[model samples]
Target: MDYLIKTGCRKIVHFAAAQHLLIGKNRQNGYLHALYKNGIPVDDNLIFKCDNYNEAAHLTEKLIRSGNTPDAIFAVNDMTALGALSTIKSIGLKVPEDISIIGFTNGLISTMSDPPLSTIEQHGYEMGQIAVRLLLNRLSKDDDGYTPEIRVLKTDLVLRGTTKTLKEDKLGRGLLY
Candidate 1:
């Protein structure tokens, strides 16, 4: 959001699976919270309730045809981001140069894009390793009064070719200013 505001993206399209899922709900809340904190009013049109790649592509194309193309787009996952990329290009627009596109889950496909993709790395492999280790430990302990514990993994933002950063001097230019 700081990046979006800094880059002067007035309209941002958000793609989510469903508000019922905790991850989806959290992502929506975070996006909206960022806009609110930046003093930008939430626009319902910018929010897409589908997370599928085909739906994202179709919806993005529709927005472009309707002359309501967004300055930026954030997809729930890399596959969906790739879908948006294809539609954006079909409409004769350049990534980052025209509209910045970002995605969650820094999967293998992310680095395969023409300009690559900027995404959030959730460290799924590491997470799986940890899960397996926990399970083995529990089995070795014979489930002897072991209490379940919640572990939170940190997420990192990996910047790549799909996004842009503006040069700022001193106070800089953005909605917050």
Candidate 2:
């Protein structure tokens, strides 16, 4: 995204996981939004739709072999990132050295990787808490005219071994340290 460009990455590949799904579509939109907001031109070629780890890995390999290797990769999820990392390694490349990688959803497996993955943490616990509260509120309200309220939970970026810090000037407020 903007950070990747500011960090001197001219080419960034996005591995989308099932764009038909709500989460997938939203993530893709966010990625495009970041690029547009940063004044980066959209490149359809760099966007690859992948459903799982295997598809991601296969695409990564193909991209490399075709001399279309990206300077950075943004995966839809930790599993996709892991698969891309495996392909990158198989091609004799180093993580955060030759290319940087980032994933969404800071799942447990992310921390256990060889070079721990840098990921965005979705506050699942807080979300569940909010959901329960909403349910209680709904149950407590006997009025049939009650309207649903929408709430947006924030996410945090957990920096780890997969990425390096960009220059201070390139840093944005969106990243939660």
Candidate 3:
């Protein structure tokens, strides 16, 4: 989202996941934080509780038809972003030209699209490896009670055919508590 703003995207539509979900909540927090830090006011209407493929298209279409066509669409995942991409193309609007898009979870299908989606790649394998190490280290400590561990996983923002050139691959991180 910060990248979108830096790339000249003013009106960004956020297709969010469920409020109760930690990942969704954290991502939304980051979105709001970026807007606040950048001095951009939040538009409640532009934020939708959507995360799936069909919902992405439906919300995107509804938004476009309402004349509140966004400058960019920040989808919760790659599939949802793809849905918005498909709808935007079908509606005769150009990606990034009309509305840029970015999504999380750099899945395989993300690269299969015509304009390979610009997505945040959560290094899941590294996360798993770190998690196992953390567990083992904790077990060796012989703690009497359970304690929580916090780890921040890094993400790679791969710029492909999505946003006009937000920059080369940039590094970011996600909080896992």
The best candidate in terms of lDDT: 3
Better of 1 and 3 by lDDT: 3
Candidate 1 lDDT score relative to the true structure? 0.85
Candidates sorted on lDDT, descending: 3, 1, 2
Best by TM-score: 3
| Model 1 pairs whose backbones collide | none
- Weakest ten-residue segment in model 3 by summed lDDT: 168-177
Write model 3 residue lDDT over 120-172, tens digit each, in one string. 99987898899999888888876676577888787888888888774334464
For residue 82, model 1's alpha carbon misses the true position, in angstroms, by 0.6
Local lDDT at 137 for model 1: 72
Candidate 3 TM-score, true structure as reference: 0.86
Between candidates 2 and 3, the lDDT winner: 3
Candidate 2 deviant stretches above 4 angstroms = 135-149, 167-177
Give a tens-digit lDDT track for model 1, residues 78-168: 8888899999998899998888998999998899998899898999999999999889877777566777765668988788887886666
Ranking of candidates on TM-score, top first: 3, 1, 2
lDDT of 2 by residue, 1-177 (tens): 555666667688898868778788888998899888877788999998975689889999999999998888989999999999889998999888788888888989999987999888988889899999999999888789667987877878787887767534364433322
Better of 1 and 3 by TM-score: 3
lDDT of 2 at 104: 84
- Backbone collisions counted per model: 0, 0, 0
| TM-score computed on alpha carbons, candidate 2 | 0.84
